[model samples]
Each structure stands twice: as C-alpha cells, then as structure tokens.
Target: MNDPDGGTAAMALGAAESGALDRDAADPGHRDRFLIPPARGGRYSDSAYLAGNSLGLQPVATRNRLLEDLGEWARLGVEGHHDALRPWLPYHALLTEPAARLVGALPRETVVMNSLTVNLHLLMVSFYRPRGTRTRILIEDTAFPSDSYAVRSQAVFHGLDPDSTVLRARSADEVRDVLAARGENIALVLLGGVNYLTGELLDISAITAAGHAAGAVVGWDLAHAAGNVPLRLHDWEVDFAAWCSYKYLNAGPGAVAGAFVHERHLGGAGPPRLEGWWSTEEQTRFEMAPVSRPPASADAWQVSNPPILAMSPVLTSLRLFDDIGMDVLRARGMRLSGYLYELLEGIGADVLTPADPPRRGSQVSIRVGTGAAALCSRLSGEFGVVADAREPDVLRMAPTALYSTHHDCWRAAAALAALLPEVS
Candidate 1:
C-alpha cells in the first residue's frame, strides 16, 4: 500500500535490497564533515548513526574553531575578552545573523544565550503573566519534560496551583478549540514545535493565531524543530520560542541555546524581566551603572556573559547551516526521513512519527513489538546501528540530513529486519 506521503513499502524494500536507493542518494563527501564514532569490527565502515534527535555528530571543524579561542585564552588571559581574535566581549554576536536565519527571526529578535530551559524561564519571566482568572498555562500532553516542569514551576512561583492551571492538548485541533474556549482564562500557550518522542510536528501558525485571537500569549519549545525543520517564528507572530543547539544544530552536548522574542516585545512594550550584566547595553555595560538599560532586543533576555568555549561550536554549526541553507537541508531531510519510514513499514514495525512531510522532520520513530529495547540494543551492539528506545516498546531512528545518507537508512532498516526475529 502506498502511504499518503507517496511512500511505498514495497518500493522502498526493493530499493534497499537492490542497493538502488543507496546509490542514488549517497553523497560520499557530505559525510566527511562529521566525526562518526568508530564501530566494532568496522562493520559498515561508518556506523549507521541515526541518533541526531538525541545528540548530533560532532562537526570536524568544531575542534579547530574551539582551539582558536583556547589559544587566545592561554596567550591573553583576561585580555582575551577584548584583544583576542573573535574577542570574548562580542563573541555572542557571531551567532546572531545565521542563528536568526535558522529560525526565521531578525538578528535583533534572536539571541544565543543559556541552555534551552534557562532561556524558556527567562522569556517566561517577561512574557508569562497571570492575573485574576487568566492564570493558567496551556501545553500539549507530550511536551518535553523540562518544558512542562518549567511551565508548572512558573505557575507555582506565582502562587497558582498547576493541577488546575496547566492545560494539556492531545492534537493541533484540540489546541485551537481549547484556546478558543479558555483563552480568556489561559495566560500562556507553550507547546513543542515538534513532539520529541513521536516526531509529530505541530502547526505553530494555526495555534499561534488561535491563542492570539483569544488574548493568550503563545510560545514554542523548538527543541526538536530548530535545525530539523524550517521555522518562521517572527512571521508566525509567536510571542517567544527557545531551542537547544546540541541536537540537529550539532553544537556538541549542553551547548549554548537560542531564544526568540517578537519585535513587538523588544522595546518599550517589553515586560519587566530578570536583569543581568550581559542584558544591559554593551557600550554602557562596563560602566557598572546601577541602572539596567537593556538593549532593545532579545539580548535583553540574556542573564550572564556568553561562555566562549561553549559558544564556539554553536557558531561553527550555524555557519555550516548558513552555507547549506535551510531550504536545501529541509528538502533533503524530508526525503531521507520519508525513505526511512517506508523501510520501517516494510519491516512490519509500526511507525509513530507522522508520515506527512509537513508534519514530521528527520526522525522516524517505530514500535517494534514488546522487545523494542532489546532491538535497539542489538541494533547497536550486534549491527553497529545506534538508535534509541523510549519506554516500553518505541525505538527512534533519526537520519540527519547533514551527515546521514540514504545508505545509512538502508543499513539501519536491513539491520532491524535481521535483528527482529532474534530479539522477538
């Protein structure tokens, strides 16, 4: 049967077996930028790394770029803040333009600062306001754990009970209906741009319009969406959004995260927020004046000085994105992810991620009976394919567009087919 996205299990299986798909989609040179881990026995030569959703492969350029900053630090010490190449004082600016393009925000509206959750809380301190009856926060049932915790804690910090105040939606339509019905009572609508576990992309524009019509502020956790999918946060009029750089952005682990605030909230209309030295205007920041003159942009949300070491890799990855461009990368991702879905379907595994190209990104999640965890273990241990398992019986395989090729997809699917009988 042909899937709605024009994917056919039979065709995909034939292609995998005949190696036609691999030959057609393989780009030998693209894989060179990433440093793939050495697999045991050198099986498959390069390990079928399908875990960019969890943690992306390191960019080969990241080491040399980081070394430049480290060398400057060693040579100049405190002087590195101002004197060294890519000086620490304005280091964060390097991320501004390209980071803005990655998420469809203007340079001023986007800032690379603390980790995802930290940026979320900082944005919340300014955007999430509950008064009288409108004291609730709306979120999808499956939002990332950190987003839920941060939203719940924000409610409690304002002395509101989470049980009564945090609303959960199971689908995009439900989100709109809830906003229409309870928007008056809901102070904020925070949902993931893409559901992490299921890889179901949400309709940010539709939901944002619904929330705004109901007088509720809307924000998105773009943790799984940022580099995996194209975003138009500014055009969508999303009140705020944040995402981590460690996944599709490939900035290594625990790298600096990014935040976006609508232009409307940047200047005089921006709400009161937490203050920090980095949030102040750069020119007067050194003056150490007691007055906090925050810049008229998302940088006002920054709480501390940028961590140069952590920020270096982020810049490296963003520059790569700039070179490849989101439109090209996203088109490649849709094809790769769809091919993986077809292969998984042919193997008789239930795919959880949406088959609709617009409703999913690079990750394809599967339900491989009761032995899902074992299947994942064997896919790595026995077959040299690295996939992740979620809970009772779900396995996630992400074929990142940057380094993963059609051959990687075939190898992973072939391994799944080979291992399923043994594990089951």
Candidate 2:
C-alpha cells in the first residue's frame, strides 16, 4: 500500500464494523437496532460513514442504554423519577465528571442541558451583557447557518441591530483586525472551535486572550469540534461555550446539548439568565414556590427539567469516551485525519482544512474543483463514500475516532479518485 492505499486495512475494519452494526441495526430481531440508511444504491454498507462532522454513528452501547431506560420505567413506575433502577434524581450527575474531563472543564462549570440554540440564547442572556458602547459580537463568516440565525435573533432580543452588532472574521487576520479596531464595542466574541465547512480549528486560547484584551467576553460553539479536539475551557479563561453531542460526540441525533460556564462565574447565586424551575434551588423544587432562584453553577442556566430520554444516549456514548479517554481519541483523530489529508493530497485534491494539524480537528474539507458536490454525491450514491458536500464545492469528511478506522480513509480517497472523471 502506498500513499493512496496505505490506510486500507484500517478503513476496511471500520467498514466491517459498520456493516455488522448495520446488519444489527436493520434487523428488528437483532439485540438493539438503528438504521444508518444504506449508501445511495446499497453499493456500500453505511455510506463510507465519513460525515461524523454532521452526525456520528450510533454507539453500540446506545441501544442497550435505551433499553435499560425503558426497563427502568417498567420496573419503577412513577418512582423512576427519584428511585428508579438507575436513580433519575441524580442521573445527569453521572455524566458531569467524565464530561468535564472530556472538554477540560471543572465539574461545577459544566452541565448537560437544552439544545444548542437554546443554550446559546441562555448563556447570552447571562454572559452577553453590554453597557454604554461595548455591545457587539464577533463570529466567523463561515459559521453554520443555524448559528448565524441564533446570533441574529439574540441581537434582536437585546434591541441591537444585527448588521452592526454582528462582527465577522473573513480571515484569521481579519479577526485580529476587528479585535484591534472595534473590540472595545464588542461585548462578546463567539466562534466555532472548528469551522463546520472549512474544518479550520480556531485557536480558542489566543482568541480568548484577544477578546479579553479588548475587554470582550469570549465563547464558542463546539458542535463540530468538541469530541474531535482537545479543549481547556477553564484554562483558556473562556466566559462560556456550548456544544451539541450528536456530531463528533456520537450521542445520536437530537441528543441533549452541553454547556460550560467557567468556574469564575459559578459560585455566586447563579449568573443572571432566564428562569426555569429546574434551575431553582433543588431543595425547594417541589415546594410550589412562585419564585425561581437558580442554582449556583452552570446548572443554574437550565430553563426546564432536562429531557431525560433525549440525554440517555449521551450516557452510553460518554462511557465509551471514558473508556477510551479524550487524549487517546484526540491523538488518533489527528493522525487518522492527517492520513486522510495526505491521501487526498496525493490525488491532487484541494485541501480546505487548515494544513496545520494544530489548527485542524477530525474533519478534512477538500475541493474536487467545481464538481466536488457531485463527487461527494457519487461517493454516497455510487461509490459508497459517506462524505458530505458544502455549497459551491468542498466535500467534508470526518473520520471519527471511536468507530472510524485508518482504512476508511483509503477507501474514501480511492473512491474519490475513481469517481472524479465521471463527475467531471
């Protein structure tokens, strides 16, 4: 095996694992099931599965955990809320210790709660305070659309003009320029830890430093980056950050989201934010009090009782991370993603992800010229590659660490090289 095929064995193993999971997923009689949807014409088993940046594979443990939840409900009746087999009263707590370690946060500063947009809005309410002239937000031009929408809505919520209030970085240098010139007016800087489209890993520590220098708060949307890279939210001195666990975290679709509010802000009687009964003092949660007094940490940001079922998948996925460890996962992600990058480059593909692994994560965004989207379509529809396409061009492939093996990279690159001319 050469540059184009060196990773074959690894990828084949990954494909085989996917096939076994698919077989079990599709068969109702199998122990536990999930439907990953076959490649376009069933040409591949699970479509190369390189789009973990969009959604990771369902961990085998997820189905079992779900079954256990059902079993708990059956066995505990109404007591499941406080005295179930797994003890729902403190169920969310189980994830805190490991989840904190995964993203490099103190247990007190992290909490698994509402969806991404919802958490963003909540954190903003508490952390996005602006007075006099400091009231703008710095975000990336290439950020995902959902994020842009939420940021704009938040600006409106604060009676600010989206056009002037939303500061964007067209390039890394531009981010610095904005920080130098108008950072004083910026109350907060929100960025994706890794650009979802280009897969460029932003330097959060440096960015946080710049924001602080500008006297602006810094936060991040880690949807595509959290599990793909190592983070030190507390050490970075970040004001806050939020992420969805479904993508790189492999918690399955619509899994409960997590947020981190650095300990600097937690010890008080909660930062100022929206009111939810669940965030109220636990001792008086059911006292039927009319007022809401939020908890003293990130948990205080909650606005509702968490959807236990939505969060259950995370427990399953988190256990796997606890078993494998983030340092190990991140180390492998860099190596395998770099291998994919090398394989793509050997075929003369344009690399959209930053060449610096320090500035890249698990995904590689590559350009197959004008037909990259078509190439990506074919990878799924014809060649069984699960790569996704962004607008204009750029096929985004994320080789997840937990389930993805080295060989999948080779198979995907080979599939692309084989299909380019046809797409052209």
lDDT leader: 1
lDDT of each residue in 199-241, candidate 2, tens digit only: 8888899989998999998899999877888889999999999
For TM-score, the strongest prediction is: 1
* Candidate 1 lDDT tens digits, 102-204: 9999999999999999999998998899999998899999788898899999989999898898999988888988887888898999999989889998888
User: How does each model score on TM-score?
Assistant: 0.94, 0.89
| Residue 302, model 2, lDDT | 75
Model 1 lDDT, residue 165, Cα: 84
Report how far residue 354 has shifted in candidate 2, in Å.
1.2
